[model samples]
Target: MLTGQKRKFAIALMSGSTQAAAAIKAGYSEKSARSKGSQLAKDPDVIAYMHKTRGVEESANPEVTKQKVEPEKMPVVNTLTGDFDDPLDFLKSIMNDRSEETDVRKDAAKAMLPYVHAKKGEGGKKDAKLGAAKAAHSKFSGMAPPKLVVNNKG
Candidate 1:
C-alpha cells in the first residue's frame, strides 16, 4: 500500500532522520518539508509499513539495545605518602618548585615567612583578654532554645 514518496519518507524516518530531514530526502518540497514531514509520518499506510519492517528487522536476531554497567566507585591513586617530615618542608617544596606559577610559589613563600621570622609586637594583652572571653563563652556553651511563653495580653 505504501509505495511512493510516503514510503520513502517512512524509510528515512526509520533510519534516524528527523521529520523535516526525512521529508526533504523523500523528494518532498523543501519549503513545506517541515509540515509535510509531520503529515506523512501520521499516515496509516506509512505506520503499517514501518511496523512490518521493524518486526522483520527484530526477527533477524540483532542486538537492538545494550545496557551499559558502571562501577560503583572509582579507584583513587594517592601521590603524596609522607614525602615531607614537617609542614614547613611541604611549603618550602612548593615555593622552590619551578613548574608552579609565579603567584602560587609567592603565596607559599608568604605563608612560610611568618613561621621563619617572628613579628616585633606579636605578644600583647589581647591574648590574655581572648583567653578570658573564651572562658566566659564556655560558661554558656549551651545553644539558644525556642521561646515558649507567649505574651498575648498587653
Candidate 2:
C-alpha cells in the first residue's frame, strides 16, 4: 500500500536517519518535511512496511513503539580474520567501510597505510643518504683520537 516515496521514507527511518532528514531523502518538500515525516511515520502503510522489512510479526507484537532501534552491531575486526585474504586487505576494508565509526576507520587507515605506502621518517627529503651520513659522523665527533706515542712505549 505504501507508495515509492513513503517506502523510501520508512527505509530511511530504519537506517537511523532523523524523521525530517528521512523525509527530505524520500523526496518530500523541504518546507513541510518535518510535518510530512511525522505524519508519514504514523501512517499504517509505512508502519506495515517498516515492520515487514524488520521481520516483526504484527499479530505477536502488542504495541509498536516509535523509538529508533538500531540493528545488531558488527563484530570488531581487530586481527587478521580468515574471512579476508590478508591483513592489509582486512584493514583496508575496515578503513573504507562507511558504516564504521570514525575512530575505528582512522585506526584501520593508520594500520593499513604503512603496508600500502612507505613511511618516511620525520622532516627530510626522500633521498637523505647524505643527512644520514652526517648524523653518523656527528655521533663520533665528540671522542678524541688515541695517543700514538703512548702506545709505542708498550
Candidate 3:
C-alpha cells in the first residue's frame, strides 16, 4: 500500500532508524522531516506493514512492540570534593604540577593554554565568504595558495 518515499521511510524505520532519520533518508527536507516522519508513522497502513514485516503483533502501541535497548552511559564528573572547583581547575593543577608525568602534564597544559591565550579580534564579526575558504583549507593540511603565473614570448 505504501509508495515512493513513504515506502522508503517505512523500510528504513523497520531497519532500526528513528522516524526523523528515516524521513530524511527518504528524501524529505530536514527542516520538516521530524514532523513528517511522525505523521507517517501514525498511519494505520504503515503501522500494520511495519508489524507484519518485523513479525511483531499489531498492538495499541506499535512503538512499544519494537526491540528495547539500553542507552549508553554518559561520563559524569563529581565536583563535590574541595580538591577542584571545576574541570578547568583540575586541568590547571595537573598542568602546573611537576610531579605528574611529563607527557600527561604537557597534555594538560595544552588543554588549558587555549583559555589563557586570546586571538586578536576573535569575537568580531565574521566574513560570510570565509566558509568556502575554510572548507578548502581543511581538505589539505598546510594548504597554500598557488603562485600566479604570467609569461610573454616574442
Candidate 1 clash pair list: none
Write candidate 3's Cα lDDT for 83-140 as tens digits. 7667789898777775444566788988887788976556634543475566666645
TM-score per candidate, chains pooled: 0.36, 0.40, 0.39
Runs with alpha carbons beyond 4 Å of true place in candidate 1: 56-154
- Poorest 10 consecutive residues of model 2 by lDDT? 72-81
Clashing pairs in 3: none
Error of 1 at 96 (Å): 89
Alpha carbon deviation, residue 71, candidate 3 (Å): 21
Candidate 1 displacement at residue 24 in angstroms: 0.6
Q: Model 2 compared with the native: what TM-score?
A: 0.40
- Across residues 1-154, which tens digit of lDDT does each residue of candidate 1 receive? 4657887887778777889999999999999999999898778777765654454332333344111112222123333446788889998888887644466688899999999999876877998788787878865588868889988999
RMSD to the true structure for each prediction, in A, is 25.3, 11.9, 21.1
Off by over 4 Å in 2: 59-154
Between candidates 2 and 3, the one scoring higher on lDDT is 2
Q: Rank by lDDT, highest first.
A: 2, 1, 3
Question: For residue 23, what is the lDDT in candidate 3?
Answer: 97
Cα lDDT tens digits for candidate 2, 56-129: 65654455545455645312334433597688888888888765546668889988887888767645674588
Q: Rank the candidates by TM-score, best first.
A: 2, 3, 1
